[model samples]
Target chain A: MLHRIEPRSGVAFTLKRGQRLKVSDPEGEQVADLLAFNADDVDEVISSGRTLDYASRIFLTTGDPLYSNRSNVMLRLEEDRVGRHDFLLTPCSADTFRIIYGDEHPHRGCFGNLAAALAPFGIGPDRIPIAFNVFMNVTVDGATGELKVEPPRSRAGDYTVFAAEMDLIIGLTACSALQSNNYAFKPIHYEILD
Target chain B: MLHRIEPRSGVAFTLKRGQRLKVSDPEGEQVADLLAFNADDVDEVISSGRTLDYASRIFLTTGDPLYSNRSNVMLRLEEDRVGRHDFLLTPCSADTFRIIYGDEHPHRGCFGNLAAALAPFGIGPDRIPIAFNVFMNVTVDGATGELKVEPPRSRAGDYTVFAAEMDLIIGLTACSALQSNNYAFKPIHYEILD
Candidate 1:
């Protein structure tokens, strides 16, 4: 069963292993990031590592430490809940925009926004790796086994915190509009510390 | 450069080209979609085109039509800014999670909760797509050319609406967490209609 995080001081803090975070949205989905770091901060993000990606708001784990093309540590994971929830995957790309939106829109290569944000670090579409999603839930059709995005089981103040083993750059965004699955949107909070 | 969408009425509405939307999160970001349909159905998503991925909570633009993925018809657009000031974005995936967080922690193959949510879709480690950062803001340094994630430029009651040209699935999450940033975690509200 899913659980909500209750900070000891009545205020939510960062997440740690063996901790549970909960969230509740009015009618839509609620998303949040547990932690994130820069890839270039560590010696090497070995495979079978773990960390959080703030941009996609999901937890990540790897079998090998991720290395930036610049030879910097991209990320490493300590723990994960991918089997439990629909952790985030990869960021939407400009190519996705073309495929989903069509070619008639004003913005031709809209993925440029995300690329621009990562450009300073020399990160690009080809270099962008998969992301992780934490806490959020996605229901699967038991019969067909098809996956569907579901309302999160998390409530307000529910959180998870992780310790950073390396330097990293984290990016997160609270979704703005989700009319596709009804107005099932909710608010979420996050916290991180040393 | 960006604008806001304000409906004259309180009921949920649609938006067309040349419209605007606004948000008020103090340092919040807003994302909007353009649809092709104008029916009173919840699952009437058309094309998920023309996304206002990173608009400040103060004011945004919705004059452009979000394109469609499968159909040719463009969804009409409308505007209605009601309810609390909440914007959202869905998390990404595991490989991405690794790229961003692996260096900070120690674990591998951990996709966190997002993987669980997407598992049902057969969207394995290889199928995840890059996500869109709807409302978060990041600035790039001019002289040093460094990218910095910063506060948003929006406020409450500002919104942008679009018409669905085809059936689309919209994803969102309200974010106000300040674990990595300087702002305090706040809640945001959102609404949608035909």
Candidate 2:
């Protein structure tokens, strides 16, 4: 059975070691923010620095291992249809809106959504780290080190497969930031595979 | 009074709002990892994403405001003798040494130093986020998005002044990673200014 994550919403669940997760962009240009924490030790959460440092690259894809703070492999990217992803960015939140868009009343973005979804698992907002932004297009100007967020290049039905290297608590979101999805919202489709 | 953070060590203290803290490299080619949290609420901590987003640039210098995750200004770079700083990478840890350097018995890097120094304030290892790396030089290849850590250009006496925008618990470290400090660990000097 496939599970659907509503637009701007999120979900959290445990994935046993060796399990695979297929996250799909049913609607083209949608973004998903993914977080992983070791189920046995929540303190050992994913570390973007460790992953990027080991890979020596910012763009990660198939065969890349996602590492935890304790130098343990938590997940591996087994397959990918969209190659552009962002690990340098934090999930958008109410603060993102208020600060960037100047919105007085803002909707809870992916950060808040993840906080709510993962709260039942005993994870608090403070524990959340920089997420692996799936299908999110971000570019850095090398000359000046400026960052730009652009619409994703993922086509409809494009997906990525992640193989759990350890028992993991996974939190995934259909990103809510307008710029991340080109100003439109769409649901995310995901399925667990043996 | 001047405070000295010994090589490969760290210190944590409070900076009242409107006060300024000057961090200096007493010896050349050193790196300092700095972390800030709202003194009132530890959950509201420094955010690299918010700061980079608001500034639209990764190389922060004088006049750039360091933001909290809540989108509030925590500190502003009032003066910078070394213009290049890194908000992109994370503080090195035992995991970094083990994973990157393949060290069997790795020394606890900045992450562990900060954890020990900040423990008195009730902050845990899990709560630590990516720190603002002072005097650390990192370059990215635009074509490949690969990262390269280079020796810092800051000479002896190079310093930066951060004016607190809010009451903050500040953690500062004389980086322990050999690569970050060009293989020589040196002391970091700091002073509070009215």
Candidate 3:
């Protein structure tokens, strides 16, 4: 069945029995599709030496074959409560790490986190893909053509689940605490129900 | 006077006054330029409201034209501690926001921050620019050609400072939260020095 999160928000497509979702973030834009997987699939992937971790409300899933370089399924939603937030693009690079944390330690940065997520598979900084900031609401300046960032319309606890149609690697960071606005230094929780 | 930050592991350059510093990602895909400016010039841009704020680490001086987008400068390095960090590139989107403060409210994402920063100028999501993840150390997998994230080798207080040779609006965030991984959330500070 297909579900909608808000009256005018993004749309969500649920997988039915015997249906499979093919997802991909082609162009590294950070967008994904949907699918339904059981614990066995999750265990099988992990047993193959993959890792999935979470922080605060964000979940980072990493593995092989769920997605490919040229064209691959980035993520598949298994379940979703906040459909709009489910496909929200990953946060942009600059804004992700510093906003959460203060400027106490400028030396320590997110480059490492990004590297760790991709390095295991032999991916390097040059090949890092452009991610989609799914579910996040952004606006642009009409006259000046400037981009603006803002809090999403969705609230906390809202989520979407998907099954991997291909092997994929996703990374999540709670975000540091340095922003003058928005949440700072609060712990968010997430779970992977295979 | 000009300065240079030698790469601890790779090539480094020594910069002289009026000499420009151009830095690219490790793989040499993306690049950014940096020029030295006096405190007076930096302050003029700030006083003119061309740039938003300044950090103490940066210095502004006269005789330098704060370039703008089309006709205005997007960013101005009003201060600097050259050699501490190279003006290689801008921060990542998520890290940019985290440096601003999304960690406290783990549930709240960086989108709001992006909005807040852009709202003043009437910019919106549609206008949000495709930002570059500067100075981040990402690795590409040799086998699968996948990108990975990693912690930066930059030390505490190591910063990448530069003037907006062109008027370009920028969004920044500090990433790297344990909530995302095992990396502890660290604070990042910003100063608008004149």
The lDDT of model 3 is 0.29
Runs off by more than 4 Å, candidate 3: A1-69, A76-80, A83-104, A107-111, A177-181, B1-194
Report the Cα lDDT for candidate 1: 0.32
> What TM-score against the true fold does each predicted structure earn?
0.32, 0.96, 0.31
- Using TM-score, give the best candidate's number: 2
All candidates in order of TM-score, best leading: 2, 1, 3
Look at candidate 3 and tell me the lDDT of residue B101.
41
Q: Please provide, for model 3 over B59-178, each residue's C-alpha lDDT reduced to its tens digit, 9 standing for 90 to 100.
A: 123223333211234343434332222111222224333433445434222233444544554444322222222333433232232333444444444454444443233333333322
Among all windows of ten consecutive residues in candidate 1 chain B, which has the lowest summed lDDT? B3-12
TM-score of chain A of 1: 0.49
Per-residue lDDT of candidate 2, residues B1-194 (tens digit):
99999999999999999999999999989999999999999989998867887776778999999988777899999999999888877789888888789999998899999999999999988778889999999888766788888999899999999999999999999999998889998999999999
> Which segments of model 2 are wrong by more than 4 Å?
none
Ranking by lDDT: 2, 1, 3
The per-residue C-alpha lDDT of model 2 at residue A142 equals 75
Off by over 4 Å in 1: A1-28, A33-38, A41-84, A93-114, A141-145, A176-188, B1-194
- Arrange candidates by DockQ, descending: 2, 3, 1
